[model samples]
Target: MDLDQLRTFDRIVRDQSFTKAAAYLNITQATASMRIRALEQLLGVTLFVRGRTVTLTDQGMTFLPYARRIIGTAQEGREALRRVERGRVSIASLRTLVSPLITESLIRFQEHYPSVDVVVREGRQGQIAAMLHEREVEMGILCWPNIDPLVVDLEPLVIMRERVPLVVAADVAARLSSRPEIAEVLALVPRVIALRWWQADPETAAALVRLAKTSVELPTGPARRLAIKGEGLGFFVNSAIADDVKAGRLVEIAPVDFEPLHRDTAMVVRSLAALERPMLADFIREIALECAKMGEIIDDRLDKVVPRKPWPKPAIPHP
Candidate 1:
């Protein structure tokens, strides 16, 4: 009758074991049994055969479809209510671009809708899109430009297209300057990398081999530290090193003459739903505005296409 009973009933039927279902549901076996019994009594029908096999009876089979439908409907209802109550908006973002402007936009959104809760998970551009497609998250911020077919809505947020030029500690740069051969330089240097986030293409890699003093790789935060320590030059988004460039902790080396990597940041949402939730829609709008305002400096293109909606609402703070 209730969601708890329906969930327990569904789990029991799916798992075919009341004990297993109870464990899965994080409840005691006795409570699971009582709930099922109560549900069966309410319907006045024996839904499950009382045996080790735990098979559904004829009556159970008849009620199975309805039970599933009930459970699904209940789940949808719960998700909707939670969305409304928490003003919860789930978003996945690339780790590099959670800047002050983005933070301000979120703060402003919360000021308008105090109940809204924002959850941000960080991943690569491709992975963020995948999360949206799977419905694991409602929205995504990604680095790549092209919209995938699976995306229900797309808003392009442009960011500065600052190429992560290679950089090294001043001492390291000085030490490597004398009689550098492409191979020798690469062998001497250990490249710092931001693990999975940095999008270094193959051509860049090959060119780096020819010019890099060593191919040292490190995780993003630590990689910055290593570069500061004069370990080796690493490729990273220009935003990541802005402070160091200003403070003289690291220096950009001679042009690698590599293709300039222009990353187009986008807000991606699944296409299936109409995004009827006001809180979620508002959250998306805030991000879109932030991107439009800040991403232009990097020549990042922020674009949004909703099949039905002809135009986005003007940027206005929520009342």
Candidate 2:
């Protein structure tokens, strides 16, 4: 029999009166009687004795435990499903952006949604893009100017803009004039260091070839380290080396009339449908907040070399 019929039967046995059972279950006495009758017909057995004080039949006694267990198990299963749905969020992000942009936001998110499990996967932009297309992750934080066709459906939120600066060791900068010509700086540098992705772009590759001899291609961390040691000139996002700049460990070389380079820091999802989840939405908002903080940090660092304008308002306001 159905769960409602079983519940009505159990309630009737407990109350020992159809009238009282109906009242307890918020149903009319006639409806409760009909449900009991239907349950008995389904099982082909009588469940109760009709008397001044009702009592359970042999069949009712045999079935009571099974009915209780079935309802309890079903409720447990539903609750388990709900917990699984509410308690997990998966995000993929670029290796470089994770520390500067995501770390603080993730900590804040954990504070707010203590029960929610946050899984962060780190990869390069291409790898993150592939994971999104394969449905391996729900959200991604990455560098913009990505033209991959797989990410065509990505709904992007531009959280920050990363400034790429030509940096050298402080000692190296002290040897040269305060504002050296681009050619003079390039001629003195032993080699150029850059991320592998920079060489992939034709225009950037050509520019690098013209600027200096490309001696090393490494991740942001190692390249910054080598540049700080005066081993080579490094090109990197300002956020990665902000502390170094402030501490006088690294110097940002501003060439005469040099055009500043920048890339967008974006958070993306596969589709608008992904935003329907409250967990994902809240996590995204936290990421945005963290990115805004990082933008300020980057601005402060960049301000040392060139004055920066205030950031524009965000298109999407947090709810």
Candidate 3:
């Protein structure tokens, strides 16, 4: 019926004795009996057979799982609260958005506050937005600006943009002329398609995948893997394919107009959290410096893809 009652119920079943369960719960035996009775009355069925060795009735067996689930959820909530109280900062980032800049920022932050804990969750743009709204996380690193509508409650603390190079197989890379312009590459790969991951609108992505003559839209990792396998070409964040580029499996190329295809990503903070300027705020300068190092990437690809859609709307971040 309630968490306490369920806990008591579960304890009794596990311990196989009312007295033992009471002692485990640090309550009197009579109180444990009352709780079990109340639970049974509420359910209109007896849970355990009254005996030396306690046993569950048929209905009790069926109810155990549900009770355990509630207890587990309560325990998780308590743990999350404990972490937050202890000064742990939870941040969610799009999986592709793992740039070295963020990694460097984190390294600098840890050096200053080694005792503070940080939790990182990697997800899509929309999921990160939901986490920010729910207060499940205090900070979010995502592509584009998701806080426009929720502007009153959220603040765009840092915005980062970087050139995503077009990567191709070693053989394919050798054939293309050195430093081709955007129009030249498009002319060469007439079948290539574009993807906009900033807002992750299903309709926009669907159209890109639908209208494009070749090259299925892919997230960071798979796109790299496919390029390495000599399957196709893709635009990728530099950090994501550093190893492959160095190893000569993939070659990175830049077009004069490549910037138009990239998206902008931002680090957002809840306005209330900004006012508090919690531990994370201490590293703002470090993050900004890192962002500067990467340089700002503007001009959303959807505007390039849809042309009609507004610019600065949002990319696949990193691996």
Top candidate (TM-score): 3
Task: Output the better candidate (1/2) by lDDT.
Answer: 2
Number of the predicted model whose lDDT against the real structure is largest: 2
Off by over 4 Å in 2: 1-86, 197-205, 296-319
TM-score order of candidates, top first? 3, 2, 1
Error of 2 at 184 (Å): 1.5
Summarize candidate 3's per-residue lDDT along 1-319 as a digit string, tens digits. 7887999999998999999999999999999999999999999999998887999999999999999999999999998788767567678887766566568887877765665677878887777778888877777777765633543355666667766666777876676677776455444443443434556534423443444457566767777777777676665666577789899998877765444345578777666334244355554445666666666734322122222322221123359
lDDT for each of the candidates? 0.67, 0.76, 0.68
Error of 1 at 240 (Å): 1.7
Off by over 4 Å in 1: 1-80, 99-101, 146-160, 174-202, 209-216, 256-260, 271-282, 288-319
Ranking, lDDT, top scorer first: 2, 3, 1
TM-score of predicted model 1?
0.58
Q: Please give, for residues 1-319, the per-residue lDDT of candidate 1 as tens digits.
A: 8879988988998999999999999999999999999999999999898788688989999988998998888778988888767557788888777773368778877777665667778776667777877777887767555444555355443343435566777666666655454444445557534334343454665566456444555657888888788766666666678788778888776543445443455565555253566566666666766665544545432223322233334346579
For model 3 the local lDDT of residue 171 reads 73
Report the C-alpha lDDT of model 2 over 108-207, residue by residue, as the tens digit.
7666677777878999878899999998789897766567776777766544676777788998899888678767776777888866543144454347
Give candidate 3's error at residue 49 in angstroms. 2.7
Give the Å shift of residue 34 in candidate 2.
49
